[model samples]
Target: MEHIVELVGRALLAFLIMMVIARLLGKQTIAQMTYHDFVAAITLGALTANLAFNVQMKIGHMITVLLTFTVIAYLLMILALKNRSLRKWISGQPTMIIQNGKILEGNMRKLKLSLDTLNQELRERNIYNIEEVQFAVLELNGEISILRKPEYLPVTRKDLKLKAGRQWFPIELIMDGKIIQDNLRQNNLTIEWLMSQVQKKGLTIAQVNYAVKSSNGQVYFDRYDDQMPNPIDKE
Candidate 1:
């Protein structure tokens, strides 16, 4: 019983320490975490696990080790931010893998990236044909950034000298038979207006599984029942 109590107490202490350390480190998404950050995370996790279950180990000594690592990581982050050279050394730099529709074999070889992987990355970005890509850069985070030839780019309204109105995202007016009054008020819409739109579609608030009001004052709805024919089939 004493061993179990010690285990639980140590686990709780480790959890608190981890939370405090993480808060000090600030926010970093999985994709944004640098190589150093990744290593620190893994090391801290290992130490915390050992602290939790390793009764033979001293709790105070384990905490000191964990805090030491956290302090070092935090200091490194500060130094990297202040020193550009250190930043580059820590995270590396983006490598140009493709230039002028031609692959840079030397760069690819240095990065240990295969031709098949390059082709797969291109296809993921919807550029199956290498001729369409003017430049492709492999970022330090393992993401590929592509630049297409000017001629292959999509034509925009400004390119055709056509005036386009400002675009707005659709607002959810109702969800799961509940009226979103907050959204309606923010968008300057009324319950009566929403009711009319639902009636036009031969639906009630309860019947509507989801509903959104488009920027152009159009209300789209999905009914709870699947009795309606598929719009794809109609098309």
Candidate 2:
């Protein structure tokens, strides 16, 4: 029982320490994590696990090591942000694997990427044929970025000589029956105005599952009960 209690306590402490270190390292999505970031993450996880499970190891020494790794990782992040040359040296640069509808075999070989893998990545991007790609870059994070040929690209409103109106992101005023007062203030809306809009849809604030104000000054509401008949023909 005593051993179990010590293990639990250690685990909690390690978790809190890891959380603090992660926050200090800043935020980067999995897709955005470069080679150095990946190494640091793995090292941190191993250290944290050891700290949690290895009871014989001195907790203070392990914590000091963890903090040292975090500091180094944070410093590297700062250097990467300020120094372009150092960033390229540490994280590497994006390599062009495809150019002008042709696969660069030499670059692909240098990156240790197989032609099959390249095709698979291209297929994931919805380009089955390499001929459709004007340019393709292998990002440092191992994701492929593709630029489709002009003829293969989707036609936009600009290409059709059509005028496009200004667009705005929708602001959530109410989510899951909870009022978002900050969103209301941001959009210069009031609780009274929101209640009125909810009433217009035959719903009270409590009945609303989601409520958003669109950029075009339109209030869109969805209720908890979605039993309303379809307005459009299914056929």
Candidate 3:
């Protein structure tokens, strides 16, 4: 009974620690993890499992090791974000697999991406004919991004001679009840303006789940309690 209780306690501790560490590590899905991120994830998983089951090892010692590794990994990620060259070195640059309907055999050799695999990826994107590809890049995350030839490209608003609304990158002003000061400053906005906007919406910043400055410099808010009637997902 004591052994079982100890095991359960260890599992719960490991689970909580892993959750906290994962949140601190940032939000990159398995498909988006870079090489370093992948290595860190594997290492962390091993350490977490050992922390739960390795009764021979002292828990404090194992936790210390795990935390130290997490710190190193976090610091590396921060440095990578700030340093473009370092980021490229860590995550690697995208490789051009196809250009102007011509396959880059040498580049594919370097990536070890077989023609069969390339064809498979292209087919998944509904590009059955490689000749239609103007440019196909193998991204660092092992996904292929393809640009169709101009002639093969889909018709857009311009093709129909229709006016289109200008698009802008959405800037986060508030996320998870916290103001994004840097983003606000980047857009030459002030807290007074942000507060006034929130006030107009009958909300305080604390009550907002997220807020963004979108197209035509409009502020969009998503409150924590949306108060929608019968939401589509019904969650």
Candidate 4:
């Protein structure tokens, strides 16, 4: 009754506060989140979450706290954008995890990334072998950006003296144990051919991890293996 009403009121105020503060923080602040940004997000969530359970805190009190944080966060964001020194201080420069096909043991130790963790991230970026990486940077946002050895990179038109056209995304023909008939039709492929191809690989549609159609009239497939070959033969 009365307790429920009070709880509802506090919840509404907390919601309003969060909405206003999030609006003040620009989209990029939320989008390209760095380590500090993640901390701030957690802090804000905890602050609001407590408001609902803590009867001692009033709606106005929560709003004031929210306003204080919003101003500080917004001012710091502006300063970071306008002042290069502040930006560098607030968001530390990207740390080179690997360079020249060699892992920086000191940097890895400093970042607290174990060899196994580093290897996992590399694999996610389609880089299985660390020796193959020319550069591996641990971004401030905790994302690993990789640059592979020149030999491993795609052969550009300049490299082979071949003409290039617009690069296009591949369409998924089957996903999650279901036939994507629309995609098959769009790519001018048939279910019978698809089944035949899968059977050739000793696989069924259930075993396929991905099926994508490239603009070059090629269909690619991947098994459950993340390390599977690219543009897997549909034949």
Best by lDDT: 3
TM per model?
A: 0.71, 0.91, 0.68, 0.67
Q: State the lDDT of candidate 3 residue by residue for 132-216, as single tens digits.
A: 9999998878889999999999999999999998877888999999999999898898999999999999998779999998976
- Rate residue 180 of model 1 by lDDT: 96
Q: Quick one: best TM-score, which candidate?
A: 2
Summarize candidate 1's per-residue lDDT along 1-235 as a digit string, tens digits.
9989999999999899999989888786245677678778899999999999899999989999999999988988887789999988865678999999889999999999999999999899888888999999998778889999998999999999999887678999889879999999998989999999999988888899899977875788988886867545653
Model 2 segments beyond 4 Å from truth?
Answer: 29-31, 215-217, 228-235
The digit string of per-residue lDDT tens for model 4 on 83-155 reads 9888888766799989998999999999999999999998898888778899999987778999999889987
Q: lDDT (0-100) at residue 9 of candidate 2?
A: 90
- TM-score (C-alpha, index-matched) for candidate 2: 0.91
Candidate 4 residue pairs in backbone clash: none
Q: Clash number for model 1?
A: 0
Instruction: Kindly indicate the candidate among 1 and 4 with the higher lDDT.
Output: 1
Cα deviation of 103, candidate 2, in Å: 0.3
Computed on alpha carbons, the lDDT of every model, listed in order, comes to 0.88, 0.88, 0.89, 0.81
Candidate 3 ranges with C-alpha deviation above 4 Å: 29-31, 163-235
TM-score pick, better of 2 and 4: 2
lDDT of 2 by residue, 99-180 (tens): 8988899998899999889989989888887889999998888889999999999999999999988877889998988999
